[model samples]
Target: MGYHFKFEKIMSVKEREKNEALSAYNDSVKRFEEVAEKLYELLKKKEDLESYQSMKLVSGLPVLEIRHHQQFIVNLQKSIEQYQKMVQNARNHMLFQQEKLMHKNIEVKKFVKMKEKGLHEFLEEVKHVEAKQMDDISIQHFVHRGS
Candidate 1:
């Protein structure tokens, strides 16, 4: 009975740890996804800027087109830098999440081992009790035979 109680306590602690780890991982994943989406948006904006720069004006205007193209290039460079930073941040978060998952896995393995050991001990105790009961019955039968 005491063993059972201890096993339950261990299981409860393991469960709470697992839940906390899962929540933390989920939050990390969400943040990574948001960063990825922002990066994608930035890339799309850069593509649009490139497409705009390729457009030809009706007045055969080289000067205005060149100035506009230079400004677009500068904006594109800034967007690219921002996108790169976001991607790096996301990668860092993913690595952190992976590390957390590995730790959680180790904890789960330990709890499983404890649960298995506890069950084995309980079964052995039950078996011992059953054998003792059978022995008691056999002794009673022998005494009745003599009577």
Candidate 2:
């Protein structure tokens, strides 16, 4: 049987942790992108409304209606501010997730390195034993021939 890696169980656990961390990071990124897209749309709408608000009023438009538009624009601005905050929060969350993923990655890599080192040492030991056995067999053959 092949040499069993001593740290195999630990390595597997670390790998699973890394996978979970990656999934969480991806989710965080997706959520951040969604919030950012919404913020962009809100900003675009605010810009369009502000431009429309700047237009000269003709006799066709009622004064009450114009004031309502102005009030609506103010409310929209407040909504935009709130969305901006949400976007920022999402970005922060994404950063936190990224950090967690990085930590997991590091842990997995450490275990992988340990396993590799262990395997290399095992192979070297096996090689040495094989060479020693070969030497002993050749010496025995020579002794039998001499007899």
Candidate 3:
């Protein structure tokens, strides 16, 4: 004997949508991490360049070299700032999505529990009916045989 509930299919649909949103949020987080990593590398490179500039023994280094170092440092600062903001924003969005997912999961769980409870009740009812019918049949057979 099988017991089925009408809301099972609706729960599946809600689960699928929540999963898809989570996947997309994860992808965004990964992209933000990559950008942050690249920014860190650029900052490191800029620091190395600054260190080299300070360690120069020759006082007559070309003006172009000095200008290049300055420009590189500025660009690295801007990149770091931009990526930091991006990472923060992505993290915030991910948090919001996670909260939404949690709520959705809670809803689905409630529906699932309800469906299970309903199915259990239905099974119990079926069993009771079957048992009653068997008792009736046995009583009738006994009476007929006795007569």
Give the C-alpha lDDT of model 2: 0.88
lDDT (tens digit, per residue) of candidate 2 on 65-100: 789988888988898899889989999999999999
Candidate 1 accuracy as TM-score: 0.82
Clash pairs (backbone) in predicted model 2: none
- Looking at model 3, the pairs that clash are none
Residue 89 of candidate 2: its Cα lDDT?
93
For residue 55, give model 2's deviation from the true position in Å: 3.6
TM-score of every candidate relative to the true structure: 0.82, 0.91, 0.79
Deviation in angstroms for 124 in model 3? 1.4
Worst 10 residues of 3 by lDDT: 54-63
Summarize candidate 3's per-residue lDDT along 1-147 as a digit string, tens digits: 688788878988988877877787777778777877877787788789888888772655678888887888888888888877877887787777778778877887888799889988998999999999999999999999999
Q: Identify the candidate with maximal lDDT.
A: 2
For residues 37-133, could you state the per-residue lDDT of candidate 1 as single tens digits? 8878878887876666566544355887779777877887898798789778887987787788778778878888887888898889988999999
Which residue window of length 10 is worst by lDDT in model 2?
Answer: 52-61
List candidate 2 stretches off by more than 4 Å: 56-62
Better by lDDT, candidate 2 or 1: 2
